[model samples]
Target: MTTPYLLILLVIGLGAGVSSGIFGIGGGILIVPALMYWAKFSQHAAVGTSLAILLPPVGLAAVTEYYRSGNVDLKVAGIVAAGVLVGGWLGASIANQLNGHTLKLVFGLFVLLMGAYLTASAARAI
Candidate 1:
C-alpha cells in the first residue's frame, strides 16, 4: 500500500479505537463508514472488514480498563456475546445477498434513524 493509504488506515483505527473506548461503539458506528468513505470500500466490504478488525481480542485493553473500574459485567457480556454470534451470522448472510447500492441505502437509513432517535432521547434528558 502507498504511504497515504497506510496513513488513512492508521487514522481510521485510531478513530475507531478512541470512539469505542469512550462510547462502547465503533465497528458499525465508525469503522464501517470510515472504511467505505476513506478507503473506497463497498458497503459489504466495509462491513466485513470492520468485523475482521473487531475480533473479540481487539477490545481486551478497553475491557480490562472497564473491568478495573467495575464497569464490566462478565455474565451479561457472555450472554450478549452468545446472541451476537448468532445474530452476526444471520446478518452477514442477509448482507451478502444484497447489492451494494441497496446495502448502502439500508445502512444510511439505519444510521439516520438511530441518530434521530438518540438525539431526541438525549434532548428529553436535557
Candidate 2:
C-alpha cells in the first residue's frame, strides 16, 4: 500500500477507535461505513475488514477500566459474546449473499433506526 493509502487507513482506525471507546460501540458502526465510502470497499469487504480489525484489541483497556469501576458483568458479557460468535457467522453468511447496494440500504436503515431510538430514549430520560 502507498503512504497516502496507509494514512487514510490510519485516520479511519483512529476515528473508529476514539468513537468506539467513547460510546461503547462496535467500531464496525463507523469503520465499515468509512471503509465503504473512503476506501472504496464493497460492503462485504468493509464488514470483513471491520471484523478483522476488532479481533484483537477488543477494548481490553476499556473493559479493564469498566471492570475496575464495577461496571462490567462477566457472566452477562460471556453469554453475549457466545451469542455474537454464532450470530456473527450467520450474519456474515447472509451478508455475503446480498448485493452491495442492498447491503448498504439495509445497513443505512439499521443505523437510522438505532439513532432514532437512542435519541428518543434520551429525550424521554431528559
Could you tell me every candidate's TM-score relative to the true structure? Answer: 0.96, 0.93
Off by over 4 Å in 1: none
lDDT of 2 by residue, 27-61 (tens): 66889988988899988899999999987766586
**How accurate locally is residue 91 in candidate 2, as Cα lDDT from 0 to 100?**
94
Off by over 4 Å in 2: none
Angstrom error of the Cα, residue 84, model 2: value is 0.5
Candidate 2 C-alpha error for residue 37, in Å: 1.1
Residue pairs in clash, model 1:
none
- lDDT scores in order: 0.92, 0.88
lDDT by residue (tens digit), candidate 1, 40-123: 998999999999998974558889999999998999999999999999999999999999999999998999999999999999
- Model 1 residue 61 CA deviation in Å: 1.0
Colliding residue pairs in candidate 2: none
Q: Give Cα distance to truth, residue 86, candidate 1, Å.
A: 0.2
Q: What's model 1's lDDT at 126?
A: 100
Error of 1 at 103 (Å): 0.7
